[model samples]
Target: MLLEGKTVLITGASQGIGRAAAVECARAAANVAINYLGDEAEAESVVAEIRSLGREAIAIRSDVADPASAPAFVAAAVTAFGGVDVFVSNAGICPFHAFLDMPVAVLDRTMRVNLHGAYYMVQAAANQMVAQGRGGSIVAVSSISALVGGEYQTHYTPTKAGVHSLMQSCAIALGRHGIRCNSVLPGTIQTAINKDDLADPEKRARMAARIPLGRLGVPEDLAGPILFLASDMARYVTGAALLVDGGAFVNLQ
Candidate 1:
């Protein structure tokens, strides 16, 4: 009930963390605008789920990686819900690859989608919030990889670090307008992004064994943290990074 009557715009809501967060926010009574570039049917399902909660919901097809799409994405939300009250920059992709022979195409695309996408979306949302003169919240989904390195994720980690850093800078720049900016660093969530890697039961078990929680995270695990950051409860909280990793980050030796 924290975001009752608010308008929440989320990117990459077709699946995973974004989808979970969108549905959770709607459960809290917020109208939601979902952005997705893949699988129209998947996006529609999320919309249907949110609608079932009796909240206004719209599915917008937008690619955050495209610079021009950011403004358009926010505009679509504004058109549907009047104005943006909460913006979640959750669109990202991670292609597992070794550092030694990482292809330029993989690195460039990852940077564009994960890092640049957040930048564009956040800026667009902040501008809208500033114009509205009522302030708002922007939550970026960074990753635990931002704090730790990965042997096979050479090209992916930096973008996530950049997303976290972007939230820090945006917090300072938008603080005057009362716009709160924060980042959520999630750990090893079982999503389509890493379905291939986690498919091996032994590997997943080994990874889970290292976590203090004795399990890998799921998309729903991040929904609450994201909702908190977007709601009024975090009014005084900005320029912060909250780890939704189930104690995994601290458990590291």
Candidate 2:
């Protein structure tokens, strides 16, 4: 009920953290709009699930990396939901590869989707919120990788860092408009995105053991923090980088 009568727009809501956050937001009484690419069946299923929760939901297929599509996505949601109250920028991709052998295409695509996509989406959402004359919340799904380095995530981590920095700067720029911008820095969460990387049982267990929480995270593990940041409960919180990493970031021994 934290978001009763509110409206939330989420990018890449067809799966993983985005999918869980969308459902959780609906449970909190917010009508939802989801943006996805490539998977129509999966995206529509999420729409069906949200509708089942007695909350209005719509799924639009748009390439977040397409700069123009960002405004289109936000405009469609605003038209359907009347106004936008919360925006979750969560569309991203991670293609693991050695830094020395990294291909230009992979790096380009990663940056385009992870960092550029987030920027476009956030900008459009802020414009609508400003026009509405009502304060709004923006939560970008950054990653713990933003705070640290990764053997195979050289390209991806920088984009995450950029996202975190975007929130910090935007928080300052939009505060006068009553718009809050923050980011969630997630740790290793088991999802389709990294399924192949963790395919080996031994490798997966080793990764989990490094975390203080004694286990890996799931998509749902991040929903609460996201909801908190997007709700009135966090009205005083902005320009914050929340680490939803199962305490993994500080477990160095």
* TM-scores of all candidate predictions against the true structure: 0.98, 0.99
Query: Which structure among the candidates has the greatest lDDT?
Result: 2
lDDT of 2 by residue, 1-253 (tens): 9999999999999999999999999999999999999689999999999999999999999999999999999889988989999999999999999999899999999999999999999999999999999999999999999999999999999999999999999999999999999999999999888999999999999999999999999999999999999999999999999999999999989
Q: What would the C-alpha RMSD of candidate 1 be, to one decimal place?
A: 0.8
- In model 1, the Cα lDDT at residue 53 comes to 94
Taking the tens digit of each residue's C-alpha lDDT, what string does model 1 give over 154-177? 899999999999999999999999
> For each candidate, what is the lDDT?
0.94, 0.96
Model 2: which residue pairs collide? none
Q: After superposition, how far is residue 100 of candidate 1 from its true place, in Å?
A: 1.6
